[model samples]
Target chain A: MKGNFYLQGFLTFLKIGLFTIGGGYAMIPLIEREVVERRQWLSKEEFLDLMSLSQMLPGVFAVNFSIYIGHRLRGFRGSLALAAGIVVPSFVIILLIAMFFQAFAGNQVVEAIFKGIRPAVVALIAVPCIQLGRVAHITLATAFFPILVAVIIAIAGVSPVYVIIAVAVGAYCYGRFFKEG
Target chain B: MLFLELFCVFFKIGLFGFGGGYAMLSMIQAEVVTSNHWLTSSQFADIVAISQSTPGPIGINSATYSGYISVVNEGYPAIVGILGSLIATVAVVLPSFLLVLLVLKILNHYREHPLTKTIFAALRPTVVGLLLAAVIVLMTKDNFGSVTDTPWQFCVSVFLFLAAFVGTFFYKVHPIRMIILCGLAGFLLYS
Candidate 1:
C-alpha cells in the first residue's frame, strides 16, 4: 500500500513534468490544482511554504518544489520517485533531439524554421527579465546595480561569476552597515 | 575525460545557479558557451526554445541537450552522447538534491532566519540583472542574422522580434503560441 501510494505520486509528478511547458511560475497553478485540490496532499499554506522554500534554495525550481512535497509525503523514497518522474521526460526528449537533429543539420526548411524562431526566442528571454525586475521591486535607487551588471557583462564582456561573488559580499555588507534586512 | 568535464561544469552551475532556471541562464552561458565552447550561441538559443516548449526547467533541458551535443560534436558516438546527457543532468541535479536534503533538518528555522532574509532581499535585484544579462548576451548576430549577409532575413527577424515582444509582454500571448507562429512564419517565408 505504501509503495503503491509513492508509485502514484511518481505518476503525478510525471504528469506535472510532461505538461509544464515553460516551467517556473507556470507550474504554481498546476501544482495547486493537482496537489492541493485534487489529491488533497498539501494544504494551501504548506504549498506556499514549499514554494517560498524552494525559492531560497538553488537548482531547478521544479525539482526543488518536488523535493519538498515528496519528502513531506514519504521521506527519501518519495523524493526520489517524484524527481525521477519529473526529469525523465525532458531528458529523453532532449536526448532524442540531440541524437536526431544533426541528421537534418543541412536541411533548408529546418534551417528556415529555426531562423524565424531565433529572434523570437530573444524576445522571450527579454520579457522575463522585465517581469522579474518588477517582482524584485527594483526601484531607481536599487536599479543602478542591475543596469551596471547588464552593461558590464553584455557590453564589456565581464564574466558573471565575478559579478555574483562581488554582489553577494557587497549586498551583505550593505545590509549590515547601511540598512537592516 | 569530457564526461568528467561536463560533470564538473554542470555541478558548478548547480551550486551557483539561483532564482530558478531563467536566472541560471547567465551561469549556463558563462560556463557552457563562453568558457567551455560546448555549444555555440545559436545552438544555445535553440536549446532555450526547445526547453521552453518542452516540460521541465531550462536548467535540466539545457544540461541534457548540451551534454549530448557537446559529446556528439566532439566526435563521440550517439550512445556515448546518452551517457553525456546522464552525467550532465545528474551533475546539475546533485547540488540542489543534496542542498534540499541538508537543509531539511533546519528547514523551518532557516526559512525565517534574518540572515536568509537579508541575503534573499539583496539577491533579488541581482537575479533581475542576471536575467537581463542573459537576454543581452543572447542578442547577437548568431540568433538574428547579420544584416550585411541577409538583409531580408535580418529585417524579418527584427520584425518578428518586435511582434513577439508586443505579443508576449503586452498582449500576453501564450509562449507556445508565439513559438509556433514564429516557426510557421519562418516556414512560410524562408522555405
Candidate 2:
C-alpha cells in the first residue's frame, strides 16, 4: 500500500507532464481530471485551495502544485518522485532542443511552423487571462489594481517584483482599514 | 564551480519568479542577459519562443535550456552542458518546494485568519494583472511581428491572433486544437 502511493503519485504526474502543453495553466483541467476525479488524492475544495496557493508561490504553478499534492499524499520522497516525474519530460525535451537548436534554428520549415504557433501561443495565454480575471472577480471598485499593475509592468517596464510587493502591501492595508472596520 | 553558480542563480529565480513563467521573464532577462551576460537578448527571445511552443512549464523549460546554453557557452563540454541543465532544473524547483512546505505549515495554523484572507485577496487580482501583462508583452513585434517591416506576415499573424483569441474566448476551442490549426495555417500559408 505504501509503495502503491509513491507509484501512483509518480505515474499521475508523469502522465500530466507528458501530455500537458502550453505550460502550467494549461495543465489545470487535466490535473483536475486526474487528481480530483480519478485518483481522489485531493478533494475538489482541497484541490482549489492548492491551486490558489500554488499561484502565490514563485516557481511554476505545475511544480509548486505537484510538491504540495505529493507532500500531502506521502512525504518528502513522494514529493521528490512527483517533482521528478513532472519535470523530466520538459527537461529532456528542452535539453534536446537546445543541444541541436542550430540545426533547426533557421530551417524554413521549422520557422514556418513556429510563426504559425506564435500567435496561437498568444491566444492560448489570453484564454487564461480572461479565466483568471473571472476567478479574481474584478469588479469596478477593484478593477484598477489589475490595470495599474499591468501598466506598471508591461508598459513602464518596471520590475514585477516591486509591483507584486506593492500590491500585496496595499491589499493588506486595505483589508485592515476597510474590511475589518 | 559553474554548477554551483548555476544552482544559486536559478534558486534565486525560483524564489522570486512570480506570475509563473511569463512574469518571470523580466527577472530572467535581468539575471541572464543583462547582469550575467550568459545569454544575449536574441538568444533569450529564441529560448522564449521555443519554450512556449514546447511541452512542460515555460519556466522549467527555459531554465533547462538557459542553463545548458550558459554552461556550454563557457567552454564546457557537451556532457557538462547536460549536467548544467539538470542542476538548473532541480535548483529552480527547490525554492518552491521549500516554500510550499513552509506555507502549508504556517497556513495550517492560520487557516481562518482574516489577515490570511486579506493577503490572498490582494494577490488574486495582481496575478490576473500579471497574466494580462504577459499577453500584451507577447503581442509585440518580436513575438508577433511588425506591420511596416513585413506587411504580409504581420497581417497573417494579426489575423491568426484575432482568430485564435475569438476562437478561444467565445468558441472555447481547446488550446491544443488551436495550436494544431494554427500550425497547419502557418505551414500552408508561409511554407
Candidate 3:
C-alpha cells in the first residue's frame, strides 16, 4: 500500500511533466482534477493551501506545487520523487530536441506546428487571466489597469521589465498617494 | 570570465523568477541583451520565438542557446560551448530547487498566517499584469512585417486570436486542440 502511494505520486508528476505545454498555470486544473478530485490524494482545502504555498515561493508554480503536495503526502523522499517526476521528462525531451534542432530547424511542418501553437499559447495564457479576474472580483477600475498594462506592452513598444516596474510603481503610488488606506 | 558571468546571470533569473517562463523574459532580455551585450535584441527576440514554439521553458531554452552562441562567437573551443550551456542551465534551475527545499522547511510554521494571505492576494493581480505584458510584446514586435505590409498575416493572426478566445472561454475546449487546429489552418492556408 505504501509502495502504491509512492507509485501514484511518481505517476502523477510524470503525467504533469510529460503533457503540460505552457507550464505552471496551464497545468493547474489538470493537477487539481488529478490530485484533488480523482485520486483523492488531497482535500480541496489542502489543495488551496498548496496553491497558496506554491505562489508564495519562487520557481515555476507547478514545480513548487509538486514539491508541496509530495511533501504533504509522504516526506522528504516523496518531495524528491515528485520533483524528479515533474522535471525529468521535459528535461530529457528538451535536451534531445536541442541536440537535433538543426535537422528540423526549417522544416515546413515544424513551422506550421509553431504557427498553430502560438495562438493556442495565447489562449492558454488567457485562461488564467479570466479566471484570476473572476476570483479577484475585478471591477472596472481594476480591470482597466491590467488591460492598460497589456496594451502598453503589446502596442506601445515598451519593454516588459520596465512595464512591470512602472506598474509596481503605479500601484505603490496609487496606494500610498491616492488611497485612504 | 564569460562563462562565470553567464552562470551568475542565469542563477539570479532562476532564483527570482516568479510566475514562470514568461516572467523570466524581461530579466533575460535585460541581462543578456541590454547589460551583457551578449546578443542583439533581434537575436533575443528570435530566441524567444523559437523557445516558445519548441517544448520546454523559455528560460532554459534561451540559456542553452544563448550560451552556445556566445561561446562559439567568441572563438572558444566547442567544449566551452557545452560547458557554458551546462553552467547556465544549472544556474537557472538551482534557485528553484533551493527555494523548494527552503519552503518545505518553513511552510509548516507560516502556512496559515494572515500576512501570507495578503501577499498572495496582492501577487495575483501582478501576475496578471506580467502575463498581459508577454501577450502585448509578442503582438507588437516589429520582426514580423508591419501590420500594413502583411495584412493577410495580420488578419489571420487576429482571426486565430479570436477563435481561440471564444473556443476556450465559451466552449471550454482544451487548449491543445486549439493549438492543433491552428496548426492545421496554417498548413492549409499558408503552406
DockQ of each: 0.73, 0.57, 0.30
Per-residue C-alpha lDDT of model 2 across residues A9-50, encoded as one tens digit per residue? 888888889888778988999889998998888899999987
Q: DockQ (C-alpha) of model 1?
A: 0.73
Per-residue lDDT tens digits of candidate 1, residues A71-100?
888887888888887888878887888778
Local accuracy of candidate 2 as per-residue lDDT tens digits, B1-191: 87888898888888878767766665566567645778755466567667777889988998999899999889887788999999988888989878866767886667568877787777777777776766666676655777889788789988988998899889988666777788788889899
Q: Which parts of model 2 are misplaced by more than 4 Å? A: A1-8, A25-56, A139-142, A177-181, B1-9, B17-55, B69-80
- In angstroms, the error of model 1 at A49 is 0.9
User: What does DockQ come to for candidate 3?
Assistant: 0.30
Residue by residue across B32-143, what tens digits does model 3's lDDT show? 7656778655455545545555444456666777776566556786567677777777787667667766655676686565544554555556656656655544553332
**Model 3: how far is B119 from its true place, Å?**
2.5
For this target, which candidate reaches the highest lDDT against the unseen true structure? Answer: 1
Q: What are the per-residue Cα lDDT tens digits for candidate 3 across A4-100?
A: 8777788887887677665566678888899899999899999998887777765656667787888788876787677667766655565455445
State the number of backbone clashes in model 1.
0
Interface RMSD of 2: 3.0
**Cα lDDT for residue B157, candidate 2:** 89
- Looking at model 1, residue A43 earns an lDDT score of 95
How high is each candidate's TM-score? 0.94, 0.80, 0.69
Best by DockQ: 1
